[model samples]
Target: MLLDFGCGPGRVAGHAGRALGMRIIGVDASPDMLALAREEGTPGAEYHLVADGRVGGLADACADAAMCNHVLASLPDERTVLEVFTEIHRLLRPGAPFALLTTDPACAGIEYASLRVGEPGVSYGPGEAMPVRLRRTDGTWQSVRNHAWPVETFPPLLEGVGFTDVAQHHPTPDEAVGVADPEHVRSRDWSAERLRPPLVVTTAVKR
Candidate 1:
């Protein structure tokens, strides 16, 4: 089983459950999001509401592996980020892998397929408001503010919460071989993506 931390609307969590063929426990702080996830109904998946950064009904060290996708961007500061990690750590079994996916602050201003992060040549301080523009399906775009977390900020936090072997992977366009969707990869020019990845996945293990 896997725990999807800070799962919002269950888009990624649902897809992950189907692709990985594993039972996913999707938890979020928003009741509305959990309601939507339950309505969507992913096979072998469940949704729960997390309150005060705690997974209320879950026992300690119950989850096998856990992932947090695009969640740190919403947290305001390092203290809040650490609290979330600490709560997650309490639920993960020893040696369970924890994967955290976040938008790379370094890739700010680069226009990716689905979104464009921050402004060009604009430097955002830690936890400051980093503007992001996401492209809609209708070829329109919507703007939102996401908190900026430096790529280097995650390692010490993970290590502090009993996670070890921390590593960050910046996957480029050149590494897209055997991707599930080749057509999407060819939909746009990936040369810029090859130059710099707009996202980062940090992995660690509970110790």
Candidate 2:
């Protein structure tokens, strides 16, 4: 089975299950996201809640691969990220692949200035604690707060956690198509010019 680590709304897992026929187990901290995923009726997918953003709930050596896409930045700390990686290491057999797709903060020039969301005075930024609410498939709402980390820090952290053959690939501008939001095309166009370099995709194996 493949683990859709930090699966949000099960979009990728659903696609993989239907198109690739992979048996998928999705784990996310958000119940709302999990409910939404389940409501999608994604065949061959199971959902699990990781309240602590760690994989202590999973059985050891139970998965062939794990995919974590755009989930790293939402985590709280390097230690937590490391713990999750180690847990993934424990759950996968030797040589199992861990494919991670995370944002390169440089790609967006993410500044940590205080910003408002939903409310007029609520503020959040990198290293700040904040709650995020997501709508579930069951029409319920769930909130979660995550710590953010930079892209450059991942390689050393992965290597420190007993993963080897680490490689980070930057998706070319052409490859970035279909990845951005349709409604945000104008925003992407402006940001594409501002941040011309590619974003990173890193993969490694448990050694």
Best by lDDT: 1
What lDDT tens digits, residue by residue, belong to model 2 across residues 70-137? 67656666677887787777777888899887544443323211211222344334444444444454
For model 1, the run of ten residues with the poorest summed lDDT:
172-181
Candidate 1 matches the true fold with a TM-score of 0.95
Report the alpha-carbon TM-score of model 2 versus the true structure: 0.71
TM-score of each: 0.95, 0.71
Model 1's alpha-carbon lDDT is 0.88
Worst 10 residues of 2 by lDDT: 111-120
Please, what are the lDDT tens digits per residue for candidate 1 over residues 3-36? 9999888878888888788888999999999988
**How does each model score on lDDT?**
0.88, 0.68
